[model samples]
Target: MAAVGNRLGDATSPYLLQHADNPVDWQPWDDRALALAREQNKPILLSIGYSACHWCHVMAHESFEDRDIARLMNERFINIKVDREERPDLDRIYQTAHQLLTRRPGGWPLTLVLTPEDQTPVFAGTYFPPRPRGGMPGFADILRQVDEAIREQPGAVAEQNAALRHALGKLSRAPDEGGASALGNGPLRTCRDALAASFDTVHGGFGAAPKFPHPGGIERLLRHYALTLTTDDEPDRDALHMACYSLRRMALGGLYDQVGGGFARYSVDEYWMIPHFEKMLYDNALLLGLYADAWHATGDGLYRRIVRETAAWTMAEMQHSRGGYFASLDADSEGEEGRYYLWTPDEIRGLLDDDEWALVEHRFALDEPANFEGRWHLHVQASFSESAKRLGRPRDQVVALWESARDKLYRAREQRVRPGRDDKVLTAWNGLMIAAMARAGRLLDEPTWVGSAEQALDFVTERLVDSEGRLHASWRGGRAAHQGCLEDYAFLLEGVLECLQSYWSDSRLRFAVGLADTLLARFQDEDSGGFWMTADDHEPLIQRPRPLADDSLPSGNAVALRALQRLGHLLGETRYLEAAERGLQAASGALARMPEAHASLLTALEEHLYPPEIVVIRGNMEATASWRARALKYYTPNRLVFTLPPAARPPGLLAERVAEEGAPVAWVCHGSTCRPPARTLDALDEVLDQSGGSS
Candidate 1:
């Protein structure tokens, strides 16, 4: 065979483009590449990863860049490179297959060899080295062996592929036991109990070292606390403590960017003193809402500050000029992990005055041993009051000095070589960020944040949708590619609904309706319930996944179900309500087995069990504003408050809720029932009290 030249130069994904110049011939995953493998009778060598992945870069430099390894791969196999972010459908299927094959969890850079005839993965592993080390096989040797085995013993490969396919098919289908009765509070309680068991009392997060934020689990704790706040349950108080303490620790730790105002991927240590150093848009977006809600729940100044700073960082760094948010910042810069974020003691001291240095050294424990690679990654070691007392200065004076030091260090860090950023705008990720911005904006009374959300929504609707109104999953360099998956539709719908609460727009509501309708038509499984990750029209892969478990992102089916429920209530649409119920029935079996793993689905179930209260306020702008503000004073996850001026005409259930020109009137509804219109502020308060609005 002739040498295959790299063909990834035209790919839209930044991860794919990163390998365009590698010594290995990297073909983007497409029909042509798969066809070539089939024609040449070679097994497909599929390497899956994203641009921000640290190990992906390492593997690329170690094996893919080596001429000898490249020759072996090119001669033996048809190599295909896929950006997991761009093709999560493929990643999900293969990652699951990897687990079934290896009996171990999967991570990137995910390596696999698949039979060319049906694209069935026969072998799987992650991050193989060029030379054998750490008891792992070398990539070149693995390639030679796999190629020889496929040619010498084709029957063995076929048998394993058949078994793997059977296992994957079983995993893809929801269990038949799901029903209305299966959706119970047992799973909810089980999830809470599981979290309690795993909760680290000394530190803040669940489990031990290599701690992820687990925003979904933290959110479940918050909502659980809110639900049981009025009850006499002591566990509710403990739930609040766990959620708030975790937020506080995360904010004050190295996992959060002390200089830049965003969160790293995860903590590499239990103390939260070292992080993986990748700043992902989704992590920051999800954390923004959590911190904002924590502020609303406790009126904590720390939570508020974290929200403000993280939001500032997002808009300044992650958001594209076109309004969509980018994917993530790389973990490495200049070929070293965390090099861009790490700092030397001399660097910090030189940038600050003596008093400011003293305050910084005391507050961040710069006086102690270095944490990451013999250098500092700032984390709060002491409170402002402690630093003030230790320095014998006023608390306010110490805060001012610390602020000055941070600003100076931040400016100095800005001058350093920065981490590479993946600039592709993904619809699903942007949706998460949009919800965060809009929710925080409404809760914190920041109009700019709401405006940012609106702008992003506009970008998605205008740029990411095709002429026929189908949504695209990704956009970059003036091109939108790939049919939108379930998450793109579901998450963006969620964002649209959130934006309506922050600042209502008739067009946005229409967009949300269109999205919901498309989801029903294209993604929903009419027979089994829930939704497939890929659309009905998407190209066939090994398996069509209907994932219910929450991973780095929430489950698409769960988000879709939740969004449908909210929209159904808002519009009084029976179709959406019925669909949501069906989705719950579909996920019931999974919920019963391990509810802690499916926090998002449990959230949807919570709303199903206790239907959300919908409050519609109509009057002059000034009057409605006051009423809306009062209604949202408390953190009510199960309550939605929408305010409209008298001139505004809302659709569906809201159209019936009308007000006179000057009088401020409110209608409060729980599930299918609505209270009589309240003519005055006092009457509105009375109705809310009756409905347990604050609860």
Candidate 2:
């Protein structure tokens, strides 16, 4: 360790700023941190995590705040603390290394030991205790042992580093061993078979333990099922059914906050039992979109309820003072994960009458402890009718009583110590939220959600985006920094497009198209078929990251492709279409090795291709909500509905539509020519179905 002070004080990331006053000499991910260790021939100790990470905060307080640990760290290592959100490339490399090293899935507050000179990791693990208490060796002990290993057994450390690097280099542990003919029918079937093998029949989602929602997993399978169902419906529906099952499980599971309405970051157990507790804006936005689509497909009240409730939460908790959305809410409070969500039986019983309490307890199976300690996690059952029948109470009365209790408890709970609210508005996240709000507004037919979309859009446009029309990543108070990356560009573009569809505004369409052009020019990977994370003008990090992989959210390229596709359709620009097609093709080539990986990107591809229809509305569209009902009457997935604004010269459109004398109507367009504008929603429906088969 070098000293008590570090370069992290000068860092811009909120997570890094939290540690600016720490006793540990924490340096940001910069050359100075690496060069110092190389100069002193000391091993590098790298800790990577995010602001919302609970264990990251725990380890920081227990060990990094201690002077002795700081001294040990300075003496033996070039210590670096990286905010994972800011530097996802570093997070990805090390997380992959961790999973490979431990034969387990990786997560935040990741710890790793690396060679000082070559930037190669030698040893790694997650958070360790300050004094060897939590069934793990202390951080101080690990530091000493790692230092000794480097000093006494230098060869071993070097060998481990070499091996780690080699393994990371060979991305495919076993390449294309599936024996499927490249780019043919065999690959698709093979991929589908692999999907089925991992598919959970009872619970849904793929994989065994620590399952994720995996949006791309559902999107691709849904598309595959749709395409196959067109000609043959034998096993294609399996994928769709599997996706529904998993989605439903997630909706009902503790992964979703019953009270707050948004989902937690992840479930720790195999059963989606306990959550990591942080409420990320991005996760809710994605899930809302997923649930909305599910509602579209199934017409299920449960899915619709999830979408509405989630939108409500986003509007209430995640919305920023400036109108844009916040990044996340921390999972931990009082040094415990899920402290805010858990309650005791006494706490619950105090709020409810004896009969109501019994009914509620029986419904949610709240007799015993659900949380780690003796507290109960209020995961309510699917319905209270059964419990009402069991308790012989009126179903309506049972529902009313439960709602009253929820309101009372929620009010009381608000007075307690709340989790840290990261109110910094992020452009990428805001974009996703905007999309969800706008789309949900349309689906639910609520003007309030649309109002939220408008307010958020105004916030981004007024505060985050500059006069030059370029966007900044985040904003707080009067301060905003970090140049907007490709993700922000793609996501915001998607947001604006959704907004355009919501209001059917030509002005938003023009703005989105203009921004998309700018994004293409600035971030488009010239040689390859993707976009760089940052602009070409920005300073490069140690690694020049051109991310093709999707984790948690869709990769920038995937988002860009979808954005471009939507923009092209709106503007009638072949350039945008061509670029989008190229991106889609490139992404398709890399899908197999990472199926559940790029859910966002896969969702985009699924949206752009297959079972799609084009509905073109001409003339007055407001008769009998003629235009609105035409768009809203039927819930069709992936249909591009173009309401031709009253303009003779369509800005980017290649086609010409002639409206009759006065009546507003819709033209359901297929491959080339547009059908005559339909006077009623029924006529439009028939035309759309004739063009594209119904779900």
Which structure among the candidates has the greatest lDDT? Answer: 1
Cα RMSD for candidate 1?
A: 1.4
Clashing pairs in 1: none
TM-score of candidate 1 on Cα atoms, chains taken together: 0.98
lDDT against the true structure, each candidate? 0.90, 0.73
- TM-scores, each model vs. reference: 0.98, 0.87
**Residue range with the least summed lDDT across 10 consecutive positions in model 1:** 174-183
**Model 1, residue 366: what's the lDDT?**
84
Residues 350-469 of candidate 2 have per-residue lDDT tens digits of 977777677767866887656657777766564767877877778888777777766777777787788887777888888988998888887778879988998898898888878788
Q: lDDT tens string, model 1, 1-695?
A: 57778999999999999999988888988899999989998899999999999999999999998999998899889999998888889999999999999999999999999999999997899999998999999998999888898889989988998899999888888677533346777888899999999998988999999899999999999999888764444538788888999989999999999888999999989988899988898999899999999999999999999999999998899888878889999999999999998888888889999999888888888878998889888889999989889999999998789778889988999999999999999999999999999999999999988888888988898899998889888999989988889999999999999998987777778889999999999999989888999999999989999989999999999899999999999889989999999989988878888899999899899988888888888887776787888789888888888877777767788788778775788888888988888888889888877765555
